[model samples]
Target: MIAFPDEAAGCPLTGIVASYTPRLAALAAEPGFVAAVDQHAAEIRERLFAQGPELMPRPLRRAELTDYALGFLDALAEVGWDQPVGYDYAVDRLTAICWLVHQNGLLDA
Candidate 1:
């Protein structure tokens, strides 16, 4: 498991991953899982960057991840989502986002 800094532990995005890390790790052992997660991360990264320059004029930094995670949660709430008993695309994407953030050293930035 990636050990984020103490400061990063309080981040909502970190919390999101904490909930799913066990499953994500198991999935990582499967063939092609890493690639799929990477793809999802790429998609989400693009979406974040696509936020108008006025709102995100610079590349996304670690500090911005919390806001992004909150926005994602808000959107899920808006759509009336319920946590699934099994894996789903949202979970996969979120796990992927967490991995992306960790792998890119964003949490430490």
Candidate 2:
């Protein structure tokens, strides 16, 4: 079992996803947006490799990233879906998502 201090036990991904699902869902609905995110991730991969391979892990395909994004949104819907989430929060989530994709890749890939 994962143990976190009570004050920090809330999952950042879960909270961020829950807070921003509607916006993410809307973006996910657009093929253009998904493609752009994939392209951006590819760029990120290149930049990350420039830093060094030791910093990277197994690369994730664009579809896998999209699946994770969409799944996060779906999980959010299961909880309270009426809370208002800010645009800034949505942007932050997007940035973090891209960073996650980058971190999950290896330089050789």
Candidate maximizing TM-score: 1
The runs of at least 3 residues in candidate 2 whose Cα sits more than 4 Å from the true structure, single-residue gaps closed, are: 1-24, 51-109
Error of 2 at 64 (Å): 20
Q: Candidate 2 at residue 93, lDDT?
A: 43
* Model 2 clashing residue pairs (backbone): none
**What is the overall TM-score of model 2 with all chains considered together?**
0.32
1-90, model 2: which lDDT tens digit per residue?
211123123333334333334444555576665565556546544543444557655455554555555564565556634434433333
Q: Where does candidate 1 have its weakest 10-residue lDDT segment?
A: 1-10
Candidate 1 TM-score to native: 0.65
Question: How close is every model to the real structure, measured as TM-score?
Answer: 0.65, 0.32
